[model samples]
Target: MNRSSECITKDSSRLITTELKPPDISLVQEKSWNAAVQMFGSFLLAGFGMVAASLVLDVVQHWPVYEQVSEVYILVPALLGLKGNLEMTLASRLSTHAHLGHLENCLSTITLGNLCLVQCQAILVGFLAAMAAVAMGWIPSGEFDIHHAMLLCASSVLTASVASFVLGVIMIGVIVISKKLNINPDNIATPIAASLGDLTTLALLSWIATLLYRSIGTNILLPAIIIIIGAVLVPVCGYAAWKNKFTKQALDEGWVPVVSAMVISSAGGLILDFTVSNYKGIAVFQLVINGIGGNMAAVHASRLSTTLHTGQLEGPVISATTKLLLLMVVPGQLVFIYTIGYLKAGHTSLTPIFMLIYLSAALLQVFLLLIISHYMVVWMWKLGIDPDNSAIPYLTALGDLLGTALLGVAFHILYAIGDKDSDLGD
Candidate 1:
């Protein structure tokens, strides 16, 4: 009887261990799988969105307004970068709030205040970008006409304001819905912000600039009037955002990143302005590549910000989430590259060498961006600065700069190789 009891006790202990182990492993695997799906879906959606936005940019570049106003080309990268900064930062902020349970109500003071803050910043940055573009354009060409200046300022301010309002609202809905559906907003919000940001801002800038351009000589007052309205709305939005507690800190300390990002992006704009004309399809591919890099970095930043907000200090340097994000880049970019080839097939061919170089450039851009996002978010948190407010702008701007510079190098290399090939053939 004693031997039988001993064997039964051992068997029970073994059963318990076996039962507990599988469930634990299953739970972990389930979580990792869900995260992968969330991130992959977001990236796929963002990739397609950028493909369409790049096409729009290519189309707009041929428009009379874009060609006539050289400053407009200089303004495009800056304005689009600023739009991404504002909306993605807004998304990151909201995602953090959602993860912390502060975003349970869509009409909450926190949500509304954050939205208002983006609007105010958009107004201020929009006008500043226009001024910077004008200066950049002037330094290179030594030509500054008041008519062109007014048109750029009006277009920038109006596009920024309208895009901010629309994108801000969309961000709120996205976050709220994600929360309701038991989805992680951090996984989806930033990419959507980037995806829609390029399309909406470029479309608005194109339409508004064309309309304003038409009225330049006949009614010079139109541009001036739009600028005045944008200026007036700044104070209104500021007042609204300031009355709430959740966003007051951001409003006080957020200008550095946003303004600095705009400057960095303007530098990229200058690069684009110089190199785009010489290259066959740089404009189309540049927007797509830049947006992809920024979107991936923003995803990493947004996820890290949420983790940091939840009080996890010593997290893994390269989490499964980061790996998933980095992995998505290759396939996502391959699709965009070939899509560009198909779209611009008449103008430019996607040779194997060019595609390989472009892919390498994109991979390098995203890999560096991921590393930066990881360190920047942690560093900002240690400094008592909110990563959600600070990291996305800088990361996205850096993405824009890296994407443009690397793309320029790739084209230059291709050109040299082509020249050599022609000589060899001769």
Candidate 2:
């Protein structure tokens, strides 16, 4: 038995050696270091930017439609933050090189084409969702006319889409840098991209709002119409891109992501709008879909593609999977927090912000508990452990806390801000 066990150990060690890819020491030293700095800086800026935008928007919401409102400052972060969770979807995939296969190339045409299509599709989906909110009255009709609302919606789509597109390009570039430096894009891309998207999207959203209010006569009627137009056109544009020769293959290759993202985004808006119209308050109702779907695992497949310089096939899978999983975990958990806060203080906003504040006092609460699980999988991989061996399921179950903690922290922060404002008033 001892001799048999020794033989088995020898075989296992050999298998591990055969599967491992050698590290690129020089690449890690040069390119990776730079990328890390930029990525970290970007994350901090985004976080601060979001806080600023939220405050600005809160102020804008108080103004009268067509009342010469000048709170355009909020536009900055609102644009970036609007699609906070989504921008990472494509950025990570393209950088990771998941396109050709689980193990593939990065600079390939297939990868680029797919990035274009997915980005466009995501934009359309976002538009549809935003519009559906307006259509169903989930997003309160501004104290203005339908035309102004339409304008806001239209501008929102263009701003969000354009910003998302630019960010995708930058994210891919950074991931490529990570790959060139022999670092795994997966490790760096998601967090950085997520933060950037949040910052840039929110900022842009606020800018669009300001611009629309100025040139469109501030009637508020146009924002809704604009949103409807955007919701209609964004997907059509994506479909058109699909028919383009370069992306035709990508379109075929990534049909499911394009279709599904559009559907879900649109559906979510409609559903949330329904809830809002019926309930009648400033509830963080978007969770009915987005929060639930956030935790799905694309797990750097597409990012791996870009890092490996591979194909489009990997990105959408990761995007779709991550979105699905996150939806299930985030919404349900945050809703609980929102309910708790409302019951206690009788005010509401996005639930995630409230939960985040729970962190300030209770370090090991539900939200904080998730951090261990979220990071463990990440930590295990750093130790060269493959999740396929045993940890995947446990890690995923544990990941439920990532969203919970994030939402908790978010909820807590927002609630605290509101409280501060109340105190000032009192």
Candidate 3:
């Protein structure tokens, strides 16, 4: 009887184990599916926004301002990158704040303080990005015209200032609405900021440049006047940020990532400047690859930061979120590649070789970036730094570099293989 009872008990224990395993497996699968639904949806929206932005860039490339002001191409990535660093960081920070329950009142002092802080950073970075672009544009040719310099500077700073303010407001609204709707702002906020960041910044940049360029040497001093106004507001925004207890930590932190990101993006701009003229659809594809890669990394970074803040940084998050982001790259890139092929039909041929190279490059770029974002968030949290502010800037900047470099290499490979494609604007 004792032996029979022991066997029965063992059988029952085995049955229980078998019974529990399915639910555990199903639970994980369910979570992953839900995450896919959320993340992919938001990512797609952001992707389409970037597509629109890219089309705008394509059209803007033909504009008189773009043709006359050769420096505008150099300014494009720097300014857009500046936008990513500022607004996406703001989105990430706000998402973290919301997740931490600190943004229960969206208009709280913390929220407003962060807004002020971003505006301040925008003015400063915008001006600096302009300086960097102008230097990069002119230093190579050993020609520096003060008139062109003023046009570029004014256009950059004004675009930065204006775009940041507009996007800052949009980000706040997105976060607030997402919170009210029980959505993860981390999933959507950074991408939306990115989406609008590209379109808004580009539109403003083109318009502002055209306006400022026309004012050059006209006794307008409009560019100079605009610069002075931006300069004056820097200290004003700074004081507001410094005075706010909630945002003072911001002033002390985040500058390294922000400024470093600008420099890195400027390097990508140089790459674009060099390669954009050589390959057909390079400009269009550059934004798609860079924007998509950056958006994915930012999403991952924001999610990781939120997890760390919630004290849930564990093995599952590290593996699961990273996997989700990686899975997104292929499908997302397919959509973008197709759209670009359709739009640039005559100018860019959709050869199987080119498609393969493009997808392979994007996958590798996003994979490395996602991996970097994982370690970066964990490292920042371990070091007691807020990953939300620091990680996105670094990760996105790295994405820009990797995407630009990789895209350039892909084009070069095609060229090496005698795949003579049409040049840009053909």
Candidate 4:
């Protein structure tokens, strides 16, 4: 009986040990880690590119056109945000095409159709964003002049037309390259496109704005002619796109998202309008923060949408892939915030309170983006809509709005904390 009891006790102990042992990592989890690592690495590389490109903003700040037309500052983020919106949509469409085996050739009908659609959207939205920027500038500054509006509109349209064509081609190339390498374009394309979009848009906007400012000096006819040409070109492109069935489908899938993004982007500009004075010389940092946040959210939205479409992810629960993505955000936000802060403001300006406020705002931005992407993708899927068609644009737009608002809040919080600290010291 004692021997029998010993055998049972030993068996029970063995069972306990087995139960306590960690399970081998599943294939799904392994894939999630691999995907996360690949995406995080790509984002880091793209981010460095954006940082280098953003130095152009310092040059822009020194430009006479920028200084003379402060409204251009407000227009900057809106224009870049719109560029990102269109390119992000293109990336999503390409990613979906890749997954569906339609990306076998760059010159495929679907690819051409989508390209035409994006270009048309770019022309229309660029013109409108510029006109809106003029109005936004007029609201507070009350410096509404037809020549100034025409110059701004002309600058926006010309820059956008060129940038969209170039960036769209680059994104298609990225999709092809990612496919050849067996990497997910969805993971890499949107962020890279966004970074490139910001850089190229800013550079082009500055060059075109300065050139227009000089060329049309007190000449209403030249500016008026340019604006008229821009206005006429929009409907012509739209009509052409509408006539093509495939392009029409692409436009149908893309326009609402674009309009929604514009609304959200305008809100971001409004936030900048209200809070930029508080930060004084550091207004350029807003572009960096918005670009980074928007890029991160775009990556997440693109990946999540792809996974959802592929049946690899379901519902709104955070997957291992998402957890790994979120883990990447923590260090990335810290590095960007600290590095840019030091470079722009100074190391001494990065006080603990400032760090805390910045980190909190950034982390909160990422967190909100993740949650928003998850739910938005799931809801679209349930509605029989393609999340790829809508998710990235919405996420990016929301990222801009949220990033701006959060930064404003962070600034206020830091000021209050500093005041409290000074009182204590006194």
Candidate 5:
């Protein structure tokens, strides 16, 4: 939106390489009927792996103690899932922006400034959300303390921000990599992101929680805050780098800033994590809140994109509706939320109730996703912007957040009406 960003946008076309990579039929490979079969097979295998993990966790541990301990610790998984989702969502959305030429100036000052502001806002919101979750009976009640929760939340903010910073680089890299592979990064970012979120978040969260809880026992508030401050400064350096004249040409030229952002983010995260030994309990709960913020940013940003070029009021509204239906209404991540609740509570029976409630809530959620996507589609058409890959990830992520709320409400309502002596019941 600023002068520097505009310059990047004008010169964006120059970033395209005259030499594109030849299509490979392996990993970056396109799909055929055979590939579809293989994909489905892999998905089946992955589901079994999930079941096996749950079983192992269920068998070896004293389930109730684990649940109680997890009430404090469980935040890590959900938060990890959330940040994972958020990072992926934003990355995917940005990838689409690049595909659409909206991110022509990936190295522009304005872009860096915008991301820096958004990252801070995300951390703040994540912290508050962690507090709210603790208050709402989401955290382990007596097993964890305010100090533990505080440390966890603080660390989560630091860790997630660092992850997000790296994600920006990965996202930008995705575009370049896509061009090199003769594939569309727009298509690759979303699904790959969600999958990666599910996978790596567990390991990262476990390492942080184990280390932090072992040493300072959650009293390292000072260290936690200090690390967070330093982590925030990492982005400041990013903003400065984008403004430097030497690197200004690199935006339209190649992959320097993207790599730099990633390296800085990863290294900063490792340094901040040195205090992981001081963490008391359940440190990752903060990621969930951040994840939600990520979802909100992605969904709204995508919706915003669809509306930018539309000349009429209805354009965004319509486009939003279609995206909602296509993504959230179909294969939205309902299973993950219920799993979080069930796994943390160690109330496997409650999972069925959660299911009933979640499914019912999904119906309404689908409607919401549909309406918003519809609004966005029409809006984009009116605005004259090409609206496609971007909106789906945004809408899906948003639907996850909204669906969580809706499912919560549904459970509350169902509980309220249970055992009523009406014709609808026994």
Candidate 6:
């Protein structure tokens, strides 16, 4: 009877031990899977929305005014990148605040300060992007004069200022909505902000350019005044960003990422300038590919930044979060490539070779970005720097460069393959 009691006691102890063991591993895997789904879904939806916006670029390409000024194409990518950089950075900053439990229901001091900084950065960066485009255009075309440069600069500043305000409000609203829904703002905010930025900036650029073109001849004074106002406002805003304690951090933390993104984006603009003639047929596709890649990178960066801040991810090692994000990339890339091919083929004949090339380039770009984002986020966090301030802008800008380069290579490969097939058939 004592032996039987001992056996039963031992069995009970084993059962209690089993029950007491934490389900941490399984629980973590489940959470990571859910986070990955939410992020991938949000970015996929945003990417599709960007595709619809890119169709408008197709229309703009055919416009008489756009055709008249060939330099406008050189400015397009840079301007869009600037707008996206500003908004994505804002989203990242806001997401970090939300993760840290610093965000309030109303417009906090930090929120107001960030809004001011974004406006200032938008106007300042718009002016610089215009100048850069003019310089880049001069290298290839030698057709742009001060009149053209001023027009581009004025238009960029005006359009960016307006769009910044509108999109800023929308981004804040997204964060608020995400919080109310018990969703992670980091997952949704950057992608949505980036897509909206692309659409609004492109539409505003077209409208503003047309209006500026029509008015330049009749009211020369207006353009000069606008330029002067932009010149004055930049310094004033800079001073405010520098002087105010609340806004100074933004200026300090944002300049490197923002500037780096602009430089990289300018390279993308140069690519567009050189290849616009050759790839005119695939203009919309090119824009969509770059925009989607950049948006995806921004999403990943934002989430990684938040995770690092919240201590959910301690290092850059391939944690469950990293695994989930990488896995999410596969389905997202497949959906985007297939959907784009189906929709775009309706307008232009897309051969199997071309589709294969597009898919290859997109996959390569996303994979590269994932690796870069992991290392960069980890490195920044290790150095005690805020990844939120740096990661999104750097990743998005690098995405533009990689996306453009990969697309060019894909085109060449397709051509080479086609030539070989023709030769064999002959």
Against the unseen true structure, what C-alpha lDDT does each candidate score? 0.79, 0.42, 0.77, 0.70, 0.42, 0.71
Our tally of clashes for model 6 stands at: 0
lDDT per residue for candidate 6 within 351-420, as digits (tens), equals: 6666667777877787788778888887887776677767888888888788877876776676567632
Question: Across residues 1-426, which tens digit of lDDT does each residue of candidate 1 receive?
Answer: 433222111221111111111111121233766877887788778878877776788789999998999789888867887778888888988887776555543246766787789889998989988998899889988877999999999999999998998998989999889878878888889988888988899999999999998997799899999999988989998988876666776787689998888778768878987777777567777877888888889988887777666555536877777788778878888877777666653244667787788788888888888988899988887787888888888998899889999988887887778832321112
Clashing pairs in 4: none
* Candidate 6 residue runs with Cα over 4 Å from true position: 1-30, 137-146, 243-246, 266-285, 312-316, 345-361, 414-426
Regions more than 4 Å wrong, model 5:
1-71, 77-85, 100-122, 133-146, 217-222, 225-368, 376-398, 401-426
Ranking by lDDT: 1, 3, 6, 4, 5, 2
Off by over 4 Å in 2: 1-82, 98-112, 136-144, 217-426
List TM-score per model, in order: 0.84, 0.48, 0.84, 0.82, 0.49, 0.81
Predicted model with the maximum lDDT: 1
Error of 6 at 93 (Å): 0.7
Residue 390 shift from truth in candidate 4, angstroms:
2.2
Q: Show where candidate 1 strays beyond 4 Å.
A: 1-30, 140-143, 266-283, 345-356, 408-426
Which should have the higher TM-score, number 3 or number 6?
3
The window of 10 residues in a row where model 3 has the poorest summed lDDT is 13-22
- lDDT per residue for candidate 2 within 63-140, as digits (tens), equals 553244322232332233335435555544343332222223214443455455645655654555445444444335
How large is the C-alpha RMSD of every model relative to the true structure? 10.8, 13.0, 11.1, 13.0, 12.0, 11.2
Model 6 lDDT on a 0 to 1 scale: 0.71
Any runs in candidate 4 off by more than 4 Å, and if so which? 1-30, 139-143, 217-229, 243-246, 272-289, 311-316, 346-348, 419-426
